[model samples]
Target: MLPYWRLSGFYFCYFALLGGVAPFLSLYFHHLGFSAARIGELVAIPMLMRCFAPVLWGWLGDRSGQRLLIVRLGALLTALTFTGILWRQDYLWLALIMALHSFFWHAVLPQFETITFGHLGEQSARYSRIRLWGSVGFIVTVVVLGLLLDRFSPAIYPQAMLSIMLAIFCCSLLVPPAPVAATRSALPGDGFLRQLWRPGVLVFFFSAGLMQLSHGPYYTFLTLHLEALGYDRVLIGAMWALGVVAEIILFMVMSVILARFSLKQLLIGSFILAALRWLLLGFWADSLVLLALAQVMHAATFGCFHVVAVHFVQRSFAERYQGQGQALYATLSGCGGALGALYSGYSWNALGAGWTFALASVAATLAALLLLRWMPGRAS
Candidate 1:
């Protein structure tokens, strides 16, 4: 039997930790007296790990058929390695911690995603229903942590993340291994690499990478940017929460949306909206009304794009290649994210926030055009 709540519980803790980190981790580094450029480089370290770690782990998972064990091991090492942060706050040390922990952290999601789809079998449409819980968890943590940070020091951020990391490890213990039939490799004798190069796959991945690259400024600096613009911690947190709340609402109704629009249609729309969202942040973020409206665009940019990407990867690859397919997606996203981080780190101070984000908008718009050029009228 599928342990529905158990799977949901893992996502909850996983993203609840993200909820706290995504909106505020840069702020935490800022509080530690790291410059904007330093923060960007430090944050990019984990993303660099994400670029390669998932593929290595994914290969092991596919070969051994013990993906659950990998999940558990990744969870344990992630938490254990993160404890190094409590011992030192220096840049080199912090960079090492991010790299070590993220090497394992990046290992968890792809394997678990393969496991979740295996359990769902053909009823894959229900994925968003389970994934929305991740959005809820994001909202809960951001709001509650925001309130806490208003009164407390950002220095406590590591402690809070440590607690959540332990919870993720605990959640991993509850779920049984996926059924044997699901994990067994069913590699077609024709070979997986051939399937990968078949029309549109490479283009989809490249476009997806550009979209994540567009997020460089937003993810790396939004909280600090908003704080500099006179928003308080609690309000800043609410802003982040608002985006995920919108994401939750989208996940709730995704099936209807998917029925009406093909995944390629949704992906194109997501890129367009993301471009608009970055431009709004760059030029109009001081206007609370405009900012709020832009935040709501997270539904299309993240919520819809994510659901479609996962579904697309599942459909794109054969069962035996599933783990590697997901790993490739993660790899490209990590590469994009790492590049975004490095670029934003250098540009945020030199070019200023407005121009930095304007560049992000350009990346997203180009991604939208790539799809239109190569994939117009074709199904994702």
Candidate 2:
């Protein structure tokens, strides 16, 4: 229980940083007078780096049995690199800094998960109880930052974000190193690449990637879109926090939910909800009621889907390759998300919000179909 609380504290800090970035960063870039396409590029740059960085770092953590060291290093680098935003607001320089920051930031979580599961031992089903702290942190940051941004200048956004990153770095330093689980053992001579290509594994990765990709537009443009529709920062922040709050509730009950439903069912349900959620955002942007309802579905779209996917990865891979499995999941999701964000950015300018989100709906529907056809088994 102590370890759970400690890990939860780390999650709380880590995702609080994400909560700062996800809902507000696009608006910050928008305030800087960047065009929609340019803002998309700026936002996507970090995710692009995230696509590959986790694999390298995860491999090192697995090989050297130094998961906590990599997590701390990643957090420290993320804090330092993000400070570059204070010095350079030029699109190119900001993009480079964001990329470097994300490269390290992305590596931290998969290895952290490996550590977390090791600590959980046979109580893995209780992961959500701990993970819910992250959602709580996200909500706290989004709501507080939203209020702060509403009261203060948008120019202060990066400073506020930097403060959170600093705290996260400090928290990382406090985490006790997680010893390797007793299950760590060498794989067959066939290697990770071969294991990665197994039918269900490939399908799962691609499906999860597409699912995350579908979020690109929502994450990259939703704040700006709401602002364009005359919503204030506070309202925008509430909307963002609302989703995470719902996600928190879902995480709190995830073990029971998983017991009743298979991972495939949850994944498919999440994609279906995602498609509807985007369509609602696109067509009903002006309705607070509709927006609120759409936010609630994030429980399904992100929370349930994520837990099920993580469990699936844990069950699918050997203990020795656990970090690699998590890393691969992060890599595919990051790459797909980057592409989706970049594409949505270009389309936001050309097609407008309704059409751009409509496209995301389509992508999510496709992801749902793929999951239904390819991976029908329970996540066990």
lDDT of 1 by residue, 1-380 (tens): 66789989999999998888777788899999999779877876777888899999988887877888999999999999999999999999999999999999998999888888888876678889888988888878887887787799898899999999999999999978777565444455645677678677888889878988989888878988999899997788678878888999999999888878887888999999999999999889999999999999999889999999988888787766778889989999989987887798789889999999999999999988888888647455
* TM-score of every prediction relative to native: 0.91, 0.89
Off by over 4 Å in 2: 27-38, 87-92, 150-152, 179-187, 224-234, 284-288, 349-352
**Cα misplacement distance, residue 137 of candidate 2 (Å):** 1.4
- Residue range 1-380, candidate 2, lDDT tens digits: 43767899889988998888877888899999999779867876777788899899878987887888888888888889888988979988998898889888998899888888877777778888988998888878877898898899789998898888888778777777655553555466846777676656788899888888888889878888999989997788778878888999999899999888887888889999999999999989799999999999999988988888888887777777888999999999888887788788789889999999999999899988887787747644
Write down the lDDT of every candidate, Cα atoms only: 0.86, 0.84
Error of 2 at 126 (Å): 1.2
Q: Superpose all Cα atoms of candidate 2 onto the true structure and report the RMSD in Å to 1 decimal.
A: 2.6
**Weakest ten-residue segment in model 2 by summed lDDT:** 177-186
Report the lDDT of model 1 for residue 311.
88
Clashes of 1: 0
By lDDT, who's the top model here?
A: 1
